[model samples]
Target: MKNWLLHILVNAIAIIIVSFVFSSVEIEGFIGALIAALILSILNAIVRPILVILTLPITVLTLGLFLLVVNAITLAMTDALLGSTFEIAGFGMTIIAALVISLLNLVLNSFIKD
Candidate 1:
């Protein structure tokens, strides 16, 4: 439970930071960020693996660069799910924001133990 909560917190912080950093990414408020983070967490856990597998050929062909697109897809999914509260404009913006979120997650996960 503690680890789970920390994970959510990390996501919330990452989303907020990304939104602040990118004009195209807009998170309404802390609550909105939290909700977006939760949905993104769910999507990443359940959908990311399938997407990575489904697009493995492209991922391999691109020498793993296509994984960034998959991450952007998940980010776009979060925006679509959250609607106005969490809006990410354009594919490029989504990809950049996703990259920031991924880096933040990586750093936070390193500090958090399961």
Candidate 2:
């Protein structure tokens, strides 16, 4: 539970950074960002694996590059579900935003001992 909360916090930071770095992505406020982050985490943990399995052939053909598109779609899905709380404007921005969020989450999670 603590680890999950920590992950959520890290994701919130990532969302803020992504929103600032890319005009296409936006979080209305800290609360919205937090909610979006939590939603993103849930989606990644649950839905993403199913998606990867369903798209295994394409993923292999693209040498895993298609995962980026999958990430973008997830981000867009988060935005759609959360209404204006999260917004990813375009495919290009989605790629950049997803990469940034992933890197940030990895770095932040590393600092967590548990």
Candidate 3:
């Protein structure tokens, strides 16, 4: 339970960091970041797996590079669901933001233990 909350906070921080990197990825504030992060986490867990399986052939063909597209899809889904709170400008921006957020999350999560 504690770990879960910490994970969410880490994701929120990652979102905030990513927002700073790209002007197109606009997070209203910390609360917006938290909301976006939570939605992103939910989508990543529920939607990302299905996408990974569906795109497994291409994923293998690309040597896992396609997972970045999967991540971007999930990020776009989160933006759609959040309405105005979190806004990613376009598909190109989504892909870039997803990449940065994924990298940030990877680095942040490494510090936390299960």
Q: CA RMSD for every model?
A: 1.2, 1.1, 1.0
For model 2, how does the per-residue alpha-carbon lDDT over 6-93 read when each residue is reduced to its tens digit?
A: 8899899989987888777888999999999889989999888998999999999999999988988788789889987788887788
- Residue 95, model 2, lDDT: 82
Clashing pairs for predicted structure model 3, backbone only: none
* Candidate 2 least-lDDT 10 residues: 84-93
Off by over 4 Å in 2: none
Q: Roughly what TM-score does model 3 have, to 2 decimal places?
A: 0.95
- Write down the lDDT that model 3 would get: 0.92
Candidate 3 structure quality by residue, lDDT tens digits, 52-105: 999999999999999999999999999999999999999989999999988898
Q: Clashes in each model (backbone N, CA, C under 3 Å)?
A: 0, 0, 0
TM-score of each: 0.93, 0.93, 0.95
Q: Best candidate, lDDT-wise?
A: 3
lDDT of each: 0.91, 0.88, 0.92
lDDT of 1 by residue, 9-114 (tens): 9999999988888888899999999999999989999999999999999999999999999999998998999889999889998888888999999997898767
True lDDT of residue 38, candidate 3: 88
